[model samples]
Target: MKLYPIEAGNFKLDGGAMFGVVPKTIWNKTNPADSNNLIDIAARCLLIEDGNRLILIDTGMGDKQSEKFFGYYSLWGDHSIEKSLARHGFSKDDITDVFMTHLHFDHCGGSIQWNKDKTGYEPAFKNAKFWTNENHWEWATKPNAREKASFLQENLLPMQESGQLHFIQNPDSDFQQSSELGFGIYYVNGHTEKMMIPYINYNGKTIAYAADLIPTAGHIPVNYVMGYDTRPLLTMPEKNKFLTDALQKDFYIVLEHDAHNQIITVEQTERGIRLKETFTCDDIF
Candidate 1:
């Protein structure tokens, strides 16, 4: 199996929102803010080439939104899914599965695109089966008032309309082997309802797709939970358990939202679990 880090694009978000109640004096040291106080955000996705299946995890926010709509997020950068795929000699059509960690726009917006006629939306990955869990599918589709803005209809529905949407059965435990994808799925609810984090066994090492649960190395501190999380209180214990397990198992964390740092490992520190080392995806495989 081969894994590729796909750079979808970059955007800026309010540092305060990203760091939640964490003081700027603390978070700014790691994730510095711009003059406007927006921090750099990456829509980093992961591509898995395992035998006949090429599975993509998280499609970054697509380019279908209006300029006014995009201005809100301050989207930046030239890196795109097409360009990133081409770098690995692959294309959208080559993707057989799109495993979404959650349905937030920055994570799964690239799942759909405007059709050629500009009449309606269509699945961006024509040949890929869009994979999401049943609980998240329902949560996103029937979003609560707080998260409604992040779950856009244009980014979803089209996958089902195109008949490429599939749901992973709820695992009986925290981690379950995904026989079809050759990885173990870890479910965490603090970030969002039933967000799936993939625990990949590759080359005698375990790589955990941190998703929003542990977005960046800076988020290694259990208290650094995102304000966007549906249940902030629940995030702490969830993160603690995951980090403890990750340290014990020596898992390489594949960061999805960290613009600069791609992967990292954590160690038990006096303060708490802290970052041990940082490296790129290629450093491992």
Candidate 2:
């Protein structure tokens, strides 16, 4: 299987929000903030070419949102979904699977786009089967006040409306049951209801798509949980266990939101699981 890093675009978010309880003094060292105190982040997506099935992990925040709405996030960078796809000699129509880790706007917003006439929204990947667990679909569709802003109805609903949406978890299994997305799915709830981290088997190495679970290499510290997480307390155990397993197995972590660092390998340092090395996706592949 071949994996490509799809650079959708970049955007800015409040430094405080990204780091959660971690003070600005601390997070700023790693992610320096601009004069406005917003930290730049990448909506980097992953493309999997496994046989004929071309699966895309997350769609970066699409360009369909109004300028006013986008201004709120301070979107930046030259990388775009279309340009990035074309860079790799592909296009939206080439994708066969849209495996969303969750339905948060930045992760799945690119799933739908505005029609030419601006009459209505349409699925960005018309031929791709948009994949998300049934439990997550319900959780996001009827979002609570805490997460309502992140779960935009326009980004979702259209997948189901397009008759291309499908659930991953078996009906008999618990909503949190671990499953596979062609690549194995490691289900965790700390970030949201049921975020599926894909463990992709590629090039004789196990590369995990660290979706929010480890937003960036800086979040390797166990206490660096995002306040956006519905259950930060539950996140501690999940992070600890995942990090331990990753180090023991020598897994390469493919970060989705990290702006600068694309992949990081962890090791059991004297201080605990610290980053052992950092490299680009091309370096590993």
Candidate 3:
């Protein structure tokens, strides 16, 4: 199997929101904020090419959103999904599967696009099957007031309407050991209703497409949960488990939202799990 880091784009998010209740003095040390208190963020999606299946982990914040909508996030950088894929000698049409970590606007927004004439939306990858769990599909489609803004209909619905949306019919448990997609899935609900984190064993090393579970390196602390999470209290225990597993198993934790750090590994320090090392996609793929 071959893997590639897909740089969808970069944007800035409020450091306060990203670190939840963590003091700016602490989080700011690791994720230094800009003059506007915004920290760097990356929509660093992952691409896995195994046999005939070319799976895209997430699409990042697509370019379809209105200017004002993007302005709210302080979008920056020239990196885009199309340009990133082309760099890997591929394109949207080459993707056979779009396995979204979740349906949040930033993660799945690139899965769709506006139709010609801007009258409606359509699946961005015409030939790819959009993947999401049944539980998350419902939660995102009928979102709660707390997360309604993140679950944009324009970023979803189009895939289902295009007859390409499919729910993984795995066992209703925390982990799906084996799935048709040729990977293991851990279903956690702390961040949202049901966020599926994919783990792929490539050459004996496990790579966790962490999504928002571990948004950035600075968020490695169990208590450094995102303020945006609907259940911040529950996120602590869930995050602790992921961090412990990464430490024990030596998993490469992919920081989907970390701007500078694409991948990382943690070590069990006296203070608890801490960033052990950082790696770029070139080092792995």
TM-score versus the correct structure, for each prediction: 0.98, 0.96, 0.98
The global Cα lDDT (0 to 1) of model 3 is 0.91
lDDT of 1 by residue, 70-175 (tens): 9998988899999999999999999999999999999998989999999999999999999998889999999999999999998988988888999897789877
Q: Model 2, range 100-217, lDDT digits (tens) per residue?
A: 9999999999999998899999999989999998889999999999999999999998888899999896434212333445667778888898888888777788898898999988
Model 2 stretches with alpha carbons more than 4 Å out? 171-180
Better of 2 and 3 by TM-score: 3
Candidate 1 vs candidate 3: the lDDT winner is: 1
Clashing pairs in 1: none
Candidate 2 positional error at 1, Å: 1.1
Whole-model lDDT values for every prediction: 0.91, 0.88, 0.91
Where model 3 places Cα greater than 4 Å from the true spot, the runs are none
